[model samples]
Target: MEVFEPFLAGIDNPDHRDRVEEIFNWVKTRFPNLMPKIAWNQPMFTDHDTFIIGFSVAKQHMAVAPEEAGIHRFSEEIVQAGYDHTKELMRIRWDRPMDFALLERMIEFNLLDKQDCSTFWRK
Candidate 1:
C-alpha cells in the first residue's frame, strides 16, 4: 500500500481515488508476492525485478496493461468480459465488476512468460 500513496495522492477526485484503490487492493491481495511500485507515473507490479502488469486511470476506464502480448493472447476473453482494449492495454469500466480471475491468469502468465527476462521492460 505504501507504494500507492504517492500516486493516489495525485488524484483529486475522491471517487476516482476510491476506485483506483479498489483495483490496487485487488491486485495486491490477489498476488501477495509481487512487488508494487510506481513507474512511468502508474502503478506497476513486478516479479524478480521484471514487470508483470500495470494499471492506470483514465477518464472512462481503469487501463490494464499486461504489455501487448497479453492483450493479444487474451483478446477473446477480454471482449467477453465486456472491456475495451488495444494492442497494449485494456480499458475496464469503473462501474463494472472486474474479472479478478482473468486478471489473476494474466499476471500468472506474465510471470511465467517473462521468467527469463532480465529487465523490467522487454528489449
Candidate 2:
C-alpha cells in the first residue's frame, strides 16, 4: 500500500480514494507474491515483471485493466457483475458494488497465464 500512497492521496474524493485503497490492500493481502508498483500513472501488480493487473481512476468510475485477453475471457461474468467494459478495461461505477471474487479470478488467471512470459506486457 505504501507504493500507492502518493497516487491514492491525489484523489480528491476521500470515498473514492478509500475504496481504491481497500481494493489495493485486498489484492496485496490475497496475493502477497505480486509485486506492486506505479506505472503509466496507475497502480499495477506484476508477477516476475509481467503485468497481472492495473487500475486507474476516471471521472465517474474506476477502471480495472486485466488486459484484453482477461476482458474477453470474462466478458460474460463482467456483465453479470454489472460493470461496463471495453476491450481494454472494465469500468466499475462509483455507485455500484465491486465484484472482488471476479477480480481475484482475473488476477489468478493472469498470474498463471503469464508465469512464463519474459516481457512487461503480453506480446
Candidate 3:
C-alpha cells in the first residue's frame, strides 16, 4: 500500500490520522494505479497531470472533493440519492468505518468518464 506520507503528516489527531489512512487505503484498493500525493496541503489522487479527486480532514468532518465536472455530472444523482452537494463537492461527515461505497462509485464513474474523454480526443 502506497502511503501519502505528507498527507499523513498533516493530520494532528491520532483518530483523524487513522480515518485518513483508511480512506487512502480504500481508494488505493479500488484504483491501484492511482497516483497519490499531497497537493494544496491535502491528499490528492491523480493520473499524471489530470487531477482525479482529493480528501482532507477538517476540524469536524472529513471532505472529499472530486474534480469539477466529476461533481457536476453526478449532482442530480447525488441529490436524488439524498447526499448533499455543497461547493461542488460531496461532503461525507466523518465517522469511523466511513461509508465509502458511495464515494467509490463516484470515483469509478469519474475515472471512466475521464478515460472516455481521452479516448474521444485520441480518436
Which candidate has the highest lDDT of all? 2
Candidate 3 residue 11 Cα shift, in angstroms, is: 1.2
* lDDT string, candidate 2, 9-29, tens digits: 999999999999999999999
Backbone atom clashes (below 3 Å) for every candidate: 0, 0, 0
lDDT of each: 0.89, 0.95, 0.70
Q: Model 1 over residues 1-123: C-alpha lDDT tens digits?
A: 898998988887788889888878988898899999888888999999999999988777788999998999899999999999999999998788789899988998898899999988777
Prediction 1 TM-score vs. true: 0.92
Query: How are the candidates ranked when ordered by lDDT, highest leading?
Result: 2, 1, 3
Q: Which segments of candidate 2 are over 4 A away from where they belong?
A: none
TM-scores for all candidates: the values are 0.92, 0.98, 0.77
Off by over 4 Å in 3: 1-3, 76-83, 116-123
The residue pairs found clashing in candidate 2 are none
- The C-alpha local distance difference test score for the whole of candidate 2 amounts to 0.95
Which consecutive 10 residues in model 1 have the weakest lDDT in total? 55-64
Instruction: Pick the TM-score winner.
Output: 2
Q: List the residue pairs that clash in candidate 3.
A: none
Model 3's TM-score against the true structure: 0.77
